[model samples]
Target: MNHPSGLSAAAVQVYRLRVTHPTDSVTELGCRAGLPPEVVVAAESELTRLGLLRTSPAGGWVAVGPETATEELVAATEHEILQLQVALGATRAKMQALSAHYMEARSLRSARGDIETVRGLDNIRAVIDDLARTATTTVDTLAPGGGQGEQALSAALPNDLRVLSRGCQLRILFQDSARRHKPTGQYVTRITAAGAQARCLSHLPTRMILYGDDCAVLPIDHERTGLGVIVVRDASVLGFLRWLYDHHWSQATDFFVDEHESPLGLSSVEAEILSQLASGRTNPTISAELGMSERTVARIVAGLMERLGAGSRFEAGVRAVQLGWVS
Candidate 1:
């Protein structure tokens, strides 16, 4: 039962049976080892294929001649071990390279003299221009409200387009409101067609732009006036922006607008029903207010509930709020 080379106890038992009872068939070997006959047969076949055992018509199954079986088993095991070792070495090398890159980026950012707070539009624009000029690898951005105008867009768009044309990766996140704007949606579509990745979220946090690891462009005005804020050679600030983007990205829904269907543009009766539901009116009250029969109102409510995937009137109202139908 002791396997020095880490083979399973079952494998060791099967090997021992083959060596001890050279004339035994697979069924007899299985019985001796208290294993199922099928398991013993499979093991025997594998061993024979690996040159660890020999089979003969007259002798049934037997260990390979002399030390050949032992040598073959040892060689196979060593080959497997060497493969694992090589894989481990490659994995370690990759980890080390990534660690070195991260450390070097941190060092470069730390060495940049005096961290400056962007207080106005000019300061923000200066930083953005510098970051855009310096970006070599990729850039990720989330701009809400179609705020990237013709000039800014004209400048950044070309660089982004160039990057896409050359096969560098760029991902942009936008707010749902921005998609309703024709120009913004057209820009997104154009860049997307050119191979830049873009998605729309139900909501986006404050406007921000990241250029590789070295710089970030944020809004100076909380209301996103033409003002911009820039952080140059600041790794910590860039890291914070990256984390915020990831958090929003995970929660944002895919940006597929179904033009043929409208969930919130309900009919007159449906609109009345939803209004009553949002106002916490019971079905009977809703029926009286709309001058509809109780049975009819109940059916309409049921239909709306099913469409919205809600379990109750309260839940339906909550979903309406989420979908921007109510409040």
Candidate 2:
């Protein structure tokens, strides 16, 4: 017995008899189709399932046209296919997540030592890029100096946004002088608007970056960052670095605050300059230590002198102390 359109042979025969009769009881249909009553009943159920058989307005049963049944069967199959496609998409996502976990685990296993040295600026940047791409929890950065150039900031923006897009934390700390640099300010604004945290301190010890609790990157020499970097994976060292970061973070000011809004009416850089002058530090010394050009330092000093109504640097320092601007 052959079947057609997914219908059993008995079901097809029963359907044909019902179609010809147009009105028939299960026993009569079975007698005509040469099938038993039970077989006819089962076939009727199959036709009903496929929409080939339905109750008539004034009779026991009727057979629908093959076109309507074919349409109904095709629609149900298409719906099942759509459901399967959705299931496949979800499975693919899970597989990708598992692969990432496996790769990270394998890399960890291959990294035998707690300390790895990455020499040259390009190599260091590459490692940092990889870390940003793989960061799961947090990416912390301490950038010391006046500010970063627009090119460098632009280059980092994509990865910074990517980290935040994945629900990872991205926090950056820049020197107070960076607030006056337009490009740095714009970069900070963009990132902070994208869920990244940013702060500024008057001075910072060095450049360091942390990728979650797993690893930390530090310049080989704070004064010579272009030389290379050292990646520290020692848990104890990472713990200490995190502690230091937290401490500095507590003392830092939010980057969004305006310089004019300071309680003392002095920007952080100006206040730091005043403090160094009070200690009898020369302009060049302050300039070099603060990573500012001598001309910029001189300009800031002139502004401070006028604000304090002092004509000489010595008088400016004394007046700053008297005004409680410095100790």
- The top-ranked prediction according to TM-score is 2
Please give, for residues 296-320, the per-residue lDDT of candidate 2 as tens digits: 9999999999999998999999999
| lDDT of the candidates, in the order given | 0.69, 0.86
Which residues of candidate 1, in runs, are more than 4 Å off? 1-114, 118-123, 146-152, 165-167, 256-327
Candidate 2 whole-model C-alpha lDDT, 0 to 1: 0.86
Error of 1 at 327 (Å): 14
Give the clashing residue pairs of candidate 2, or none.
Answer: none
| Backbone N/Cα/C clashes per model | 0, 0
Candidate with top lDDT is: 2
TM-score of each: 0.43, 0.62
